[model samples]
Target chain A: MEVKEPKRRIPLVGILSGMISVASHLFRKPVTVQYPEVRPYEPERFRFRISLKLDDCVGCTLCEQVCPNGSIKMEKLVRENPRNKRMLYPDVNFGTCTVCRNCEEICPTTAIYLTHEFETARTKNSFLYSPLELAMDEKEVKK
Target chain B: MNDQWIELNIGPQHPSMHGVLRLKAKLDGEIIRELEPVIGYLHRNAEKLCEMGFYCDNLIYFDRMDYVGAMNMEVGYLEAAEKILGVPPPDRAKWIRVIIAELSRIAAHLVWAGAYGLDLGMLTPFFYCFAEREKILTIFTEACGSRQETNYMSIGGVYQDFNDKIIQEIKDFLETFPKRLEEIYNLYVKNDVFLSRTKGIGVLSKEVAIAYGVTGPMLRASGVEYDVRRAEPYLFYDKVNFEIPISHKGDNLARFLVRFEEMRQSLRIIKQGLEKLPEGPYFNPKAKKSMMIRLRGDGEYYARTESSKGEFGVYIVADGGVKPYRVRVRSPTFKNLSILPVLSKDVMLADMIAISGSIDLVFGEIDR
Candidate 1:
């Protein structure tokens, strides 16, 4: 029986090749998009924060049912709708939302949809958006 | 004179252990005498979660299982559901799914390349690999909204259609990615230090790999040409022309080379898919819009996709109900990780990391 040692090959050329290849990248522009300073453009269909179309609400409770994480809660409103006499609207807990867009796709009256506003950083969980804030935003947009 | 052996615990906490993998190795002067692996740290009861949700809702949970290759994970479950419901996706949808799945395969392999380099104390390749991966992730974000953990694929088809801009971006990626891949090969695979560390270490024989049920690059590197894409021919894989790279050595270096070639093959598939993409409705119009889809019949079915890690399989037993009666996920990482003890036996302690890195275990899938 013969015992053989694995052949040892010199790695000088290989090391030099790798070094040169990486060095070439230094001359190219950096790919980093500096956060907070520069906001990357969000696509049209991008699922970010959720928003409500207050006037179009039919109190379907479909968004609440479709949310996989139970992030949407429907509450009874004191003031009723002028046409449909609907009194229920949704309050969203943004903390648990996976942003899968199920609620948006499943909304019959198109009352709920994802907004382009993805930045939801807040100091407290209570500061997260509810139906009231969403309605206020919708009013401001209309004006 | 007396001989003594020391016991060492590698981690459920060590950074290089990949993810929550604990290895108990008995060492005799830096050479491992025995190795035992402990897993199940990141388990979130994936099967049980699947049973609770509607079939469509379970896609979100599958995304979390193999977080790196979420598209591939979703494909496994979607195929299973599609089979059970007797719903074949539209032709256009099938091509789109192939393109997205291959891009995900490239991204997942890039992660492995970066982490494997990190495990070997090389920092340059990690940065290089991630720089390319960022491009793929950006494309994913543009197409699917979320960059990671995207539940984009539904039972009937994809959630949305790719617009011209998205398709053009993919073309741009396809054009630029091959040169970047060559740069990666020069940076890591061709480097002598990498070859020295990985060339002949942790060799698994073809017979052993097959017996242990190791699929994907690991099995291919061991000289077994068992690719589920070629064998099972899912999606438009049969239409694409590509070769399965194989190495007879079955060592760490062979595994690295196999993945290196696999990235090229995935790029080839993407190019063909883009060229032959037809215009049609992305989703099946007859498919119901409800979140809870009710199955028409009660049956048991299994679907497997050739994921970047290995063969990811979903087995569902439906009792003609909205929720499945039983669901089981056969994760590739779990099977690949099982052979660690066999590969690590009698190897130097330093070589252990290389061997484990070659397997590319994602603990989220393994534990689940």
Candidate 2:
């Protein structure tokens, strides 16, 4: 149907929108992003990257995972302790971390806390590094 | 304490305002006698960003310019770079590009459909539109990592390949979901209120539309059937079949109808694309690393395509270098909005909102 211009100005548009906005808004799904309160839904095998703890000093390869996508690679590093003893650390390569956050969650110690930071895209493939070399390591420490 | 000729400012802060859009209206008792649109509020200097970043890094920035049409924006720069390098996408990659581009086009139009209804004072359609749009976005996020500003489209092909779940989701979206959009039209198109507010308001004639270079649904609304998809076929567009919906009224309502009909045609195009889905490699990685192909030193080529809203064109000059010498984008909203003062001149202060809403300017694009 062709719409002809009406000479009469209608005033109910704002009101109609207001009423409908309120009514349908009730039936509408809430897309609110609740941070620090609860974790939102995560799909299984949602691949991102992995984060590892440097303080726990355990060379555990448990993250080789109850396995799915072959994205996890754990490397062992030897660092001398304050007692002049050899301590073992796990170096994680994120080029392979499916970002299931499994490594951070399953670690047996309080030495690691995964920060809620994401979206670090870069031009270089080297930036996909998830090592202590990548996961916010302290260079200029409390010496 | 108001005069017969009331001067009202319909703000860079009003609700109906699309990202800092300001309108100064001269009204004679709710009827607008004159209105002016003020631009530059959301201007973030996106063009300058092009000059600052490397050709590869700049794609990320272009995605944010009019983030809604991120893929189109990415393609715009990639094509300009391709023109400079003189490397063409393989037939398989081109078809994949066209298919995903059309999907993004549909996604962008769904936003317009829902939001236009919101602007017209109907709210239910927005949710319905988003409900359907979410399905498309979900499919996008699954295929690409991000939901909105997906850097999914690489210079040659997609950044990633499609999985079985994504393919099935897209096919299901193509089939099961658009039924909700039908329910929305049935409920609102005949509501009388939506029609009375929108019909015959802000009529852009064919001559004016052509003169202003108004492409897309707005131009089609004036009975000028020129779609970049058909007029200048690129990618796999030549391989598929679709129709451009045109209306003769050229009024706000006519533009609305044009887009509604267009969604139908887009669905047809998507269906055709799926049935004829040929198998092959999505991306030709070799298209990226070759520094041998460079654009002509002194030639200028203008590429225009039918975006969800209107014709989006990119004009780039080659200094015979890898990156463009000078790039200026002719965004659809930037041009379609120029006719605002003409349309709003004799409208009511309240009606000015409807008029501007019909024009559908995105500040990201307008400011860029």
Candidate 3:
């Protein structure tokens, strides 16, 4: 008669995985990074924060229109220059900003665009950006 | 005399399915004889749609491919379009993208871990996963206006910067998450029922996984060292010191284990990125040369990134026109999901759900 050999068992298969989860508790230096002191390395090309140079902007309102979630709005501005002529700048709402960069892409003069500095969190409800912060002239405009 | 074979018609809209998925199974009492998946229930023809719109317009459509990890999917496409446009975003933007992408990965895994638990009849873990996910999504909402399909990563960089308040929120989340993960894992992972249901079931050898073109946790479960973030470094992944979790078992349990480890690694990557945040321009200031962005007819390039699911590749073939001549999207869910029919054969009927969940198919991306 032929003898049937016994099947060898594979022992402790998923044991390491369970242990690794437990071992993580020990000697794991605080993985948390203190904000500001140890800031996240935002890439030079990261498209987080929105910054505007206003000088490169035109009154096309493409940025306002192309926004996916309607986060950006372009208000017509009347600026007093040397000749007392009127100029325009877009007023942005950080609260509603989707960060899709629709304004940056649609902007004719590239004045309104996304910035690599993605560090703009605020606790106050009234900290939204206005036309003055995004326009060439430092004066706030509501056109 | 009675027939032994039984024909089971699993409907197109099953609750256990990841998205819209249909399976036709042939059974012999409790054992499955064969299984066939009828896909494309939600096909939007994403590739063809991408060819019709402007480069920026296309990114929005691409974002919906992997809805669980929409931002990560969009970033790869956004980068591809910018690469072809011959514009390199500032390093600060790239670093921010990495931080957000890693965070997005954690968010996606949270959903997966929760949904997987729900599929396996473990109700508590799913809720726990979602509760933690809510915290992550809250941070995402502050950074990028919308909740789920956040169009956060921009063409040249991100939509906004991470201020002190948001950074502190991330810090709090990181410190609390590892403990949260342990709490949930201890409940479900080591449980005898959970292991019995997953262990030694739906086994896929490492060689078979490679043949199926499966990447991410599924491939890593089979002991393959191929992560797009590591092999082809994009953003600031190179600077983050972390290991790609892997397992030799190559079974349903291994896939679950791989995702668990990846989540831990994601926290490490996020911490590294947060520490290295730079101060610079988030948007490009160069003057626009034209309203319409034309394409080059000379050469075609393929851009891919390691999304939460797996690899998302965008192949853009331009003919020197604003619209692409042809576009092909290689979604990881579509590729990773096809392995189901092969594994489902000869497996028990109850175990089929575990196997299918382990494959992690999102029909939206698969059909697209």
- Lowest lDDT 10-mer window, candidate 1 chain B? B288-297
Candidate No. with top TM-score? 1
Clashing pairs in 2: A48-A98, A49-A99, A71-A96, B32-B347, B32-B348, B84-B294, B84-B295
lDDT of 2 by residue, B1-368 (tens): 23678778876887788778887777888777777778898887766666544344456656666666667677766666555555566666665566677777777777777777777666667776776777776776677656667666655556566777777877888787567656665455555677777778888899988998777778888888888888887666777877777888888888877777777777777777766766787765554332222123345667776777688877766666655567778788888888888878777765677777777667888888
Indicate the DockQ of the complex predicted as candidate 3.
Answer: 0.06
Those runs of model 1 whose alpha carbons end farther than 4 Å from true positions after fitting are: A1-10, A82-86, A136-143, B1-3, B291-297
Cα distance off (Å), candidate 1, residue A52: 1.1
Give Cα distance to truth, residue B205, candidate 1, Å: 0.4
Please state the interface RMSD for every predicted structure, separated by commas. Answer: 6.9, 11.6, 11.5
Model 2 alpha-carbon miss at residue B112, Å: 1.8
Kindly give the number of clashing pairs for every candidate.
Answer: 0, 7, 50
Task: Give the winner by lDDT.
Answer: 1
Query: Model 2, residue B9: what's the lDDT?
Result: 86
- Model 1 residue pairs with clashes: none
Better of 2 and 3 by lDDT: 3
Interface RMSD of 2: 11.6
**DockQ of all candidates, in order?**
0.34, 0.06, 0.06
